[model samples]
Target: MEINEVQKWIKSYYGQRGWTDYGPFIRVGFLMEETGEVARAVRSYEIGRDRPDESTPPPEQLKNDLIEEIGDVLGNIALLADLYGITLEEAFTAHKEKLVKRFNS
Candidate 1:
């Protein structure tokens, strides 16, 4: 799925649920919360937690959790981008192109 397609899907999905009514501040707050969840999932998946029960999730389960959390983060990011009137594809490519030039130099 392309970023533009994903962004449109996100917009439509959120547009139906009253999420589009929230201000940028609320959207950003949700984005930050989702980011934190992604970070926590990554840490738990990479390092065995102190709890014995969490030593290691089955590979399938670990992958599922990571995917779900990352999806959440991406959704929130799309919403934030929508709120700011930013096209994720353009923004991502432009920013990445700058890095590409910097590295190639």
Candidate 2:
């Protein structure tokens, strides 16, 4: 799906619950929290944790967890972008331009 469509869905999802007015501070906190989850998921999937207390999840489960956490991170980013009046398309375009300038120069 396109970034704009995802952004609109995020807006609607939160707006339906009266969350459209959440301030930037709170949104950033949410983004950070999701980012941490993404880190943990990556660690578990890539390096396998040392927690013998729990049986290691199946590889498929680990992969699924990683995908889910990453999606959460993306959602939070979209939320932040929406809150700041920035479209993800614009962000992606700028990032692509930066990469091209850095690589093609």
Candidate 3:
């Protein structure tokens, strides 16, 4: 589905569950928590990479943790976009445009 469609679906789902809106603080907290998860995964991977000769976790486990953390980050980003009435595609496009303008200038 499109980004706007996903936002609309999320809004409807939340509305049906009696949640009208999520505050900025709540969204920020979710983002922070998701970032922490990602950081932890990165640290785990780094440790595993640095100590390959030692008893380290399996590569598949590290990969799975990183993927799960990425999913969490995406979930928080989607929640923030829904809370702010913004679409993910719009955000991405705007970001890309800004980067291009900055580099071209």
Candidate 4:
């Protein structure tokens, strides 16, 4: 699905979960937490080792962990844009133009 569709899906899913009351700060917090989880998953993937005590998730779990964390990050980011009254399409367009000027020069 496109980014716009993804944003709508996140809103619908969370709204159903009684998460409609959370503010931008709450979404930012979730974004940060999910990012950290993605980092940990990457670390485990990079280290290629597992702990006997299960301090880290096994290698097989790394892929799914990253997927889940990344999805959460995207969902929260969409919520952030929505909270600020910005459409995801407009944000994407502005961001792409910014990148092109910064990198295509």
Name the candidate that leads on lDDT.
2
- Which structure is stronger by lDDT: 3 or 4? 4
lDDT string, candidate 4, 24-63, tens digits: 8888888899889888777778884467866766667788
Candidate 2 CA-lDDT value: 0.88
Better of 1 and 4 by TM-score: 1
- Each candidate's number of clashing pairs is 0, 0, 0, 0
Q: Write candidate 2's Cα lDDT for 1-105 as tens digits.
A: 888999899889978988767788988888889889989988988888988797789999999999999888887788888877899999999999999999999
Cα distance off (Å), candidate 3, residue 52: 15
Off-target runs (Cα >4 Å) in candidate 2 are none
Q: lDDT per model, in order?
A: 0.85, 0.88, 0.78, 0.82
What lDDT score is found at residue 12 in candidate 4? 89
Model 4: CA > 4 A from native: 48-50, 55-60
Pick the TM-score winner: 2
What tens digits encode model 3's per-residue C-alpha lDDT throughout 3-48?
7677677567667875536687887887798899899789888764
Query: For candidate 3, which ten residues in a row score worst on lDDT?
Result: 47-56
> TM-score of each candidate?
0.87, 0.92, 0.74, 0.84
Q: Which pairs clash in the backbone of model 3?
A: none
Q: By descending TM-score, how would the candidates be arranged?
A: 2, 1, 4, 3
Q: 15, model 2: CA deviation in Å?
A: 1.9
RMSD of 1: 1.7
- Error of model 2, residue 79, in angstroms: 1.1
